[model samples]
Target: MRRALGVVALGVLVTGCVGPRPAAPVATAIVAPPAWRTALGPGSPVRAEWWNAFGDPVLTRLVAEALANNPDLGIAAGRVDEARAAERLARAQLSPTVSVGVPTTDSRALNAFGTASTNLTATPSITASYDPDLFGRLRNASAAARAQLLASEGARDVVRLAIASSVASGYITLRALDARLAVARDTLAARGDALRIARRRAETGYTSNLELHQAEGEYRATEQLIPQAQLAITRQEDALSLLLGATPRAIGRGAALTALVLPPIPDGLPADLLRRRPDLFQAEQTLVAADRSLDSARAALLPNIALTGSAGVILTTALANPVGIFSLGGSVLSPLFDGGRLRANVDLTVARRDQAAFSYRRSALTAFREVDDSLAGVQRSGEQAVAIRGQRDAYAAALRNASNRYRAGYSSYLDQLDTQRGLLTAELALVQANADRLTSYVALYQAMGGGWTEADVAAVRR
Candidate 1:
């Protein structure tokens, strides 16, 4: 029960617990503007487990392997655990503190009674203190700690997302090199056949020696591309191995470039987009921390109220006498002034909070831009792939016709070689198209805030 005495002997009575105020506008702005930037497909169901969409069991295994063993991710996870421990420590500050102590003393005393005596006393005491949370300092500190914890967990999820993306990008690059190499080898073989035919015709005076030499030149050039492609493939393999937290070693190749399954990207709702991103969430948490720290600093200006109490037992015994004792006390503190220190601290906290708020806003804008860029890239690449496919098919048919005409002695062999070169270029373009599509898939997933969820952040709180 509680009663308040007002001016002129007016009085009021109140009952029940007083609670926290309605949260501030800053707290409400944790996520502002429903659509961070136009959600991809409103109501589209994003797969909770995104990596599984690739459907390559080996890729899934490799991603899992890296997540478990990669040192970078391990370090990130450890930081999350550290933040959680700090949060618990901060929370403990909200409770009363009690300490137990014991002291003993002995003294030699001489009195006018004509006898000298030694007196010994043992004092065992327990002191308990509570700040009473009159100003909520401990509570504010705890809020900062909790906010820090969320940010740390967000960092961990960011690392996890990067690892998965690196693996996928490496896989795509390696396979694209593979396709290019194969095309180069096929071109070399065709050039070899043409060169031999040219040599025979030149020896019989049916084709000029200059034509034979040109065919030989083209064949060797195609041969040169093979080594270059192989070198690139090796370098890419080394990079992927490092991402997998391994030394340079042959990696298990999964699906072929053409067979790689692109995951379905769901454009979640605008509100969902605002909430799904880890960096955005992290920024918001940091802002909350700053806000609480500001409150803590502001509270410092108020008079500090402490309720301290000590209860103890004391014993003294002589040859014929004994004494038992007990005591209790409390304390209160008030700050007169501090040469503007309190105000300065409050100002500093406010500045930090402003910085945090600005960072959060910028992060949200960047996230929206990334999603837009990824979507545009996917749209253009898909259309370009369609157009390129038609071009490739037409060039292939032309090359076939030219080869048949030359073999029947109705057209020059050079015509067949030129058309084959065109066909080769077209085939490589298809490989490029496949790679572009796969990259788009990866980008889409990454833009969706590294697949972070509220539950993941909550887990780190443990």
Candidate 2:
């Protein structure tokens, strides 16, 4: 028996010298551009609280509220907590386990004398077991769990960035609707004055019924716009309320759409996106976890070594004094044959690791595209707003000339009506263009990662 045990121990020692396979190499296929296609030289660094750049206290407050109370964020936090617990469990595997137990028994039996007697036995023991990690399997598993924890944290930050962006964009739309409503009401009031003037001219016989009817029709056409604008405002308010995670209700007003500050474009190179975006960070961490998991699976093929020990005190009705007992043992469980189950596990981990690598590549490419798209939007929208503003000014001047010509009997009412229509259309277009410009900035900020960084995550972890 001793010779056989020595041979087994020798084989285990030899196997232990050959450790787990080295980690496989993973590579990302995507490449970032040298510079942004719409690069506007260096600008201000993106602030962590990017919404503050808009200089609207109400908008800032809304974003804060959404971050704190949003259900999606809460769910994300819960996932993070779960990951933390899993990490703890994995780490526990690296340490020895100790337990204590007490057991008591009573029995009645006939002895040699044929006498029935009751005897009670009580045994209390403390045991300890340890896995001497000769192959680093437990260490790799612990590392994998730690990587998963970081990935969960990154996912949480991604949700946080998304919620802030949504709140800002929703607020911008609400304010634009407010501006449209104001323009509609102002135009209706002006048309009402023109209708009164035409009535007086017709009664004095200075104008024909054709001119009087035309003015009244124009006034009514403008009147309908007020109701349309009000309806849109109500819908927009409700939408903003939802983003605030509150029941549909009236939203408070802040700076007018035109008065709101246009934040400076955030500046960063395309390659920086890898570290700036939380989604990208999450993807990278997921890959790391897969790599560690693969290592652990490979390590499973090696021999497992365990050491166990126990110490106990026994008390019995027949014993004169308490008895002490102790035991020590060691084991080696090497997978000599398992129908290739261990190798199959390694293959499965390899496949999953490759999948994670591809996922990371996809995420990096997507981040690059989003930044480029947002940059173009910010530039093109600003240019459109400029052109629309100039057009609005020209239409306003023409309306003044047309109104005077009709009142002085030099032109027909049709000429005044055409100019009025052009001016109103220009005003509405200008409002939309301005709103688009502001919202483009919001998209740019979001696409640029909303000032999220891997360093921030590390700081929180610490």
Identify the leading candidate in terms of lDDT: 2
Model 1 alpha-carbon drift over 4 Å, by segment: 1-47, 109-116, 265-271, 318-327, 407-414, 450-462
Candidate 2 displacement at residue 94 in angstroms:
1.4
Q: Would you estimate the TM-scores of all the predictions?
A: 0.81, 0.82
- TM-score for candidate 1, please give it: 0.81
Assess each prediction's global lDDT (C-alpha) against the native. Answer: 0.73, 0.78
Candidate 2, residue 351: lDDT: 100
- Write model 2 residue lDDT over 1-462, tens digit each, in one string: 111111111223334463442231121222212221211113312335778789987787777777766778879989989999999999999999999989999989998999999989999999999998888899999999999988998788788778888888888888888888888888888888888989999999998988889989989998898888877877776666666566555666678898899875423333443355677778988999999999999999999999999999999897889999999999999999999999999999999999999999888777766766666777888889899889989988988998899889899888888888888998999888888888888876776667433444344335
- RMSD (CA, Å), each prediction: 17.1, 17.7
**Model 2 Cα shift for residue 24 (angstroms):** 57
- What tens-digit string does per-residue lDDT give for candidate 1 at 344-405? 99999999999999998888777766666666677777888888889889988998898789
Going through the candidates in order, what is the number of backbone clashes in each?
1, 0
Which segments of model 2 are wrong by more than 4 Å?
1-47, 201-214, 266-270, 336-340, 452-462
Worst 10 residues of 1 by lDDT: 1-10
lDDT of 1: 0.73
